[model samples]
Target: MINAGIIGASGYTGGELMRLLLNHSEVNIVAATSRKLAGEAVTDTHRHLKGFLDLGFQNLTPEEIKSACDVVFVAVPHGTAMDIVPELLDDDVKVIDLSADYRLKTAAFEEAYAMEHRDPRDAVYGLVELHPEVAEQNFIANPGCYPTGATLAAAPLAKAGVISSVIFDSKSGITGAGINPSPVSHYPNMAENVQAYKLTTHRHVAEFVQELNRLDNSLTNISFTPHVVPSIRGILTTAHVFTKEKMDVDGVRKLYEDMYRDKPFVRVLDGSPSLGGVRGSNFCDIGFEVDERNNRIVVVSAIDNLVKGASGQAIQNMNMMCGFDETKGLWSAAAAP
Candidate 1:
């Protein structure tokens, strides 16, 4: 069994990692660190995992965590992962980062995030379906919630040379903000509110555009907008595309189905998919509509931000790194409302 350790265990992504790893037969969660919750029982900080994990949230240095586990998951914020990852890389440990630090290969974007590139020129991108080989071999950079949804929606169209350009309008639940409570995430304020916060300047834009372009050079341009909705979990991404030629909706669905047939985590919805269907699961549910008159197509993708978007993907990376079944501990069905 591979021993795993998670840094920043008090946050949403970190806690989700704990929940998923606890059920993995090949994994033994060795340590989880949080300075504020140091020495506290894991169950005390995250009651959802009551009786599942007995380990305490110890406050340990990066090196101390490296020594405790064969693999480490950096579940901290964007800038913070850069600081911790470089230190942990020195030890013989694999890292699956849940941040934007290593997702963009360009140095310019690193400066935009106020982080200096300290690791090797290469850290694998963890979009499991597209890059399964990378997922199996090395340390990974998990894709952002919005990018994951947007890319999967358009990748099939892009590969077929059917779309001229794409526009993405995505909505995410409050948990996407993090475990820490904020005014924006407050129930009273967020209820009945649908606000677009990061318009053109969102950091996730660079990743979405870059990765899509990387997948197909024919996808010349993309416009993305992200918003926060009132729900507690899930991300719904709608991709609007202008097709180069007329294509039947069934034909398009077949393309997506074929592309992801071998992929276990992605679900191609027969009709529109709501966040509720994918809640608490690692599935990226996709559905679409075709407007032949306007030469446009609209596709919707849904996922639980904490699961498919973050920690669940992290464990998926670990499964690949350790040569275990990709669905080892992630086969739990979605929780119904």
Candidate 2:
């Protein structure tokens, strides 16, 4: 069994890592760390994992985790992970960071996140579908939740080199905000409300551009806007792709199908993609249509923001980096109504 450890284990993502790792057949969770909850039963914070996990949260140092775990997941907040991840590397242990720290180049990261990067190192951007080369690396920077859904929605068109520009509009569950309660997360304010923030300046946009630009360098006209819905787990992204050439429905369908055929987690849906179809699963369900009159194709993609968007994807990276079957634990069906 691959011995794994989770650092910063008191939040939504950390709890999710434990919940999902319990389902992984070949994994043995060794340590789960949390400064505030040190020595507390993990179940206190992650009640869903009560019966399955009996470990207590630790305030272990990096050397302690690296010595005990074969693989480590750094799930701390953006600025915080930069400090922890560097210490976890340089050993036999493989590391996957679920924060924004190592996802971008130093300059871009500093610009987008507005923090100086202390550890400037290279990490494979772990979008397993697009960058399968992560299998050869010891360190991976898991893509951000918003970027995971948004980029996958438009990647096929961008890779086909058929689109001149695209705009992504995404709605995520409140959990995307994290485990903490904000004024926006208040029940009175959040219920029956659709909140849109970071209109033209969300940091995840840089990630969207960074990943797509890898496919087609000249494809630079990308825009993104995010909204928070009243839902609990999924992100639904609608991508308006303006094509340079006229695209038909059949052709657009073929593009998405061909691109995702070998990617185990991405489903090219015959009907519309909905949050329900991909909730609580690592699958990315995509559907699209062509607007011949506007030289545009609208593609929609859905994923559980906490699963395919965060923890499950981090496990997917671990699976690849360890040479395990990509779908060994994640091939299950979504929890749909």
Flag regions of model 2 displaced more than 4 Å: none
Q: How far is each candidate from the true structure, as Cα RMSD in Å?
A: 1.6, 0.8
Residue-level lDDT tens digits of model 2 in 1-337: 9899999989999999898899899999999999999989999889989789999999999999999999999999889988988788875999999999999989889999998999988789999999989999999999999999888989988899998999999999999999999987888899999999999999998899899999999998999999999998899999999999998888888888898889999988876799989888999998887889999888899999999999999999999999999987888898988
- Considering only N, C-alpha and C atoms within 3 Å, which residue pairs clash in candidate 1? none
**Per-residue lDDT for 1-337 in model 1, tens only?**
8889999888888889999888899999999999988988988878999988888988899899998889999988777787788788853788888888888875756755655666635677898888877644557888888888888988888878777888999999999988778888988889999989878778888877777777777786788888999888999999999899988888998999999999999999888999989998989999999999988999999999999899898888888877888899999888987
| TM-score: model 1 vs. ground truth | 0.95
For model 1, the superposed segments whose C-alpha errors exceed 4 Å read: 111-115, 118-120
> Cα deviation in Å at residue 146, candidate 1?
0.9
Best by TM-score: 2
